[model samples]
Target: MFSKTCEYAIRGVIFIAQKTADGSRIGIKEVAAGIDSPEHFIAKILQELSRKGIIQSQKGPTGGFYLDAQSRKHTLADIVHVIDGDQIFTGCGLGLKQCSETKPCPLHNEFKKIRDAISKLLRSTHLGEFSEQLEHKLVFLKR
Candidate 1:
């Protein structure tokens, strides 16, 4: 599972993609509202994303967040890496510091399988695809 911050980042990116696809730029306030995240927290997340080049940002009256062509093609994993690093894919389950293949945790094998599946899901899912889902009202970024 993703952290709360990661969850908001994913939702914020997808929401921005949806709006950008419709030729709109979204500010932190709009992105936060769209994804039902706290405005201040979402602002930091969005700034991190922009710094990581996952999403585009501008400054000025018309300045806001928008996805470029490359940004539209970004996968969930990309955003995850920016916000949460590779812990979800590389860290041990059950919070074991030394757990590994040789020194397996109790739930290591099962958790590895689950983690691999989640990784694959993130790598294969593009922002644009989620944007489409949101645009069509088939799925919502916010709970």
Candidate 2:
């Protein structure tokens, strides 16, 4: 499961990716409204993304947020790392810090495989490609 911040990050990336190359910049309010997210929270997420260089932000009249060329090159892993950190993908599912193949937890093998697959996909697929797949219903978000 992902955190709210992670969800917002994904949505923000996808939204920007969809409108990429249109020279359109969106404010935090607009992005929150479009994604049906809370304004303050989305703003914080946007700030984090900006700090991480995952999205570009401008100030003043023609300023807001937009995906730069770097955003197009960014993978889901990058976003996740920015918002949720590597721990989400790297930690043991059962909360066992020392769990490993030799001394596997009950769900270690299964969870590890799933985690690895998710990590692989997130690391390899860019936001642009992810947005296209999402638009085509190839990928579905539960919430």
Candidate 3:
């Protein structure tokens, strides 16, 4: 499971990715409304992403958040790291600080394999590809 901040970050990223070519910048209020997330919280996540160069923002009448070309190269892992930090993925699922193969926790081996696979997938998957997959799923749902 992901944190609320992580969920917000993903929604914000997907929203930006969907509106990328609109030329009309999307404000935090609009993004929050569209994603059903808190405005302030989403704003904070956007700011973090912007500060980390994962997303871009402008301050003016037409100012808002948007993703630049470079943002396309970013993966879910990058967003998660920006919002939640890398420790979330690296830590043991059972909260064991010393979890390892030899010194395994109750579900260490199984959880570690799942966690490692997820981490790898997130690290290697780009936002563009993620958006495409999401779009496909949405289409399937509609059908």
Candidate 4:
């Protein structure tokens, strides 16, 4: 799967997208509460997303997080790349530094297949879909 940070980031984005999809802004407290993440940690994640242009944020009493039309097109892979890099797609399964085709680890082949499948999924799953799913109650973002 994904790192804890990436997991929180995805949840945070989905929560924000669900709220913003209805043309409303959501505050950090609400987003963190919705996703069951720490407010400060989620704030940092939100700041990073904003910095990378994956989402937008504003300051002041009415300021909050919201997704733009272009941002709605971003896929899970995009957020993964921003927050976790491509390591999840390229790293060794057994955490071996030199594990590869030529110097394959015991689990390298199987793990490669799994990693590729995850990469394909992330690439194909856009935030908009998750937003819609959240809207329709097809999936739960928080426990």
Candidate 5:
């Protein structure tokens, strides 16, 4: 699973992508409300994302967050990398620091399979796909 910040960032980014796929801008309030995240938490996440160039933002009137065509092409893996690093894809499932192939934890082998599957899903899923799924009501970012 993703960290709380990672989860919110993914949700916020997808909402922005859905709203701004046509090169428009979406406010943080709208993104947070759309994904049911707290405004302050999402705002901080967005700020970090903007700082990292994972998403773009502007200040003042008629300014907010927007993802250009190239940005929309980035995968969920990219966002995960920016916010959470490669730990989720590389770390032990049971939080074992010394777990590895040779000195495997009890759940290491099985967890590795699941982890790889999740990694592939993230790597293959892009911002546009995130938007499209929401646009079609095939998935929900909120409860």
Candidate 6:
């Protein structure tokens, strides 16, 4: 599961990708409204993303957050790594520090399989692929 800020960042990025496809930049207010996130929170997330090169931003009248076609190729795992690191992939399901194959937790084997699947899903999926689903209402970013 994603943290609330990660959730907003993912949603905000998708919305920005959809809007920026026309080659126009959008401000924090617009991104916040598009993704239904708080302006201040989304602003911070976007700024961090811009700083990290996951997304791009500009200043002045035409300044805002936007992603180039190439940047859109970044995977969901990249954002997850940026915000949450690899903790989910490497942590114990039962919250034990020493949980491992030899010293397995009760849920270790089962949780490993589930975690691997999720990791694969995130690593293999790109941000660009979601714009069409969102543009056509095939997916919803917010409940």
**What would the TM-score be for candidate 4 when compared with the true structure?**
0.94
lDDT of 2 by residue, 55-136 (tens): 8889999898888776788888999998888976888998898998889999998999999999998899887775567677
Candidate 1 overall lDDT versus native: 0.90
Please state the error at residue 96 of candidate 2 in Å: 1.3
Query: What are the root-mean-square deviations of the candidates from the true structure over C-alphas?
Result: 1.1, 2.3, 3.0, 1.1, 1.2, 1.0
- lDDT for each residue of candidate 1 in 1-143, tens digit (9 for 90 to 100): 78899999998988888899866688888888888899999999999999999999989998999999999889999999998999998888898899999999999999999999999999999988876667678987777
Best by TM-score: 6
- Each model's lDDT comes to 0.90, 0.82, 0.79, 0.91, 0.90, 0.87
User: Which lDDT tens digits does candidate 5 get at residues 1-143?
Assistant: 78999999998998898999888898978988899999999999999988988889988898999998788888999999999999999999889899999999999999999999999999998888766778889989897
Scored by Cα lDDT, where does model 6 land?
0.87
Per-residue error at 66 for model 3, in Å? 0.7
Ranking, lDDT, top scorer first: 4, 5, 1, 6, 2, 3
lDDT of 6 by residue, 52-112 (tens): 8899998998788899988799988888888888977788888899998999999999999
What are the per-residue Cα lDDT tens digits for candidate 4 across 40-140? 99999999999999999988888899998999999999999999999999999888999989999999999999999999999998887776667778899
Which segments of candidate 6 are over 4 A away from where they belong?
Answer: none
Candidate 5 has its poorest 10 consecutive residues by lDDT at 126-135
| TM-score computed on alpha carbons, candidate 5 | 0.94
- Which consecutive 10 residues in model 3 have the weakest lDDT in total? 134-143
List ranges where model 2 is wrong by over 4 Å. Answer: 130-143
Candidate scoring better on TM-score of 2 and 6? 6
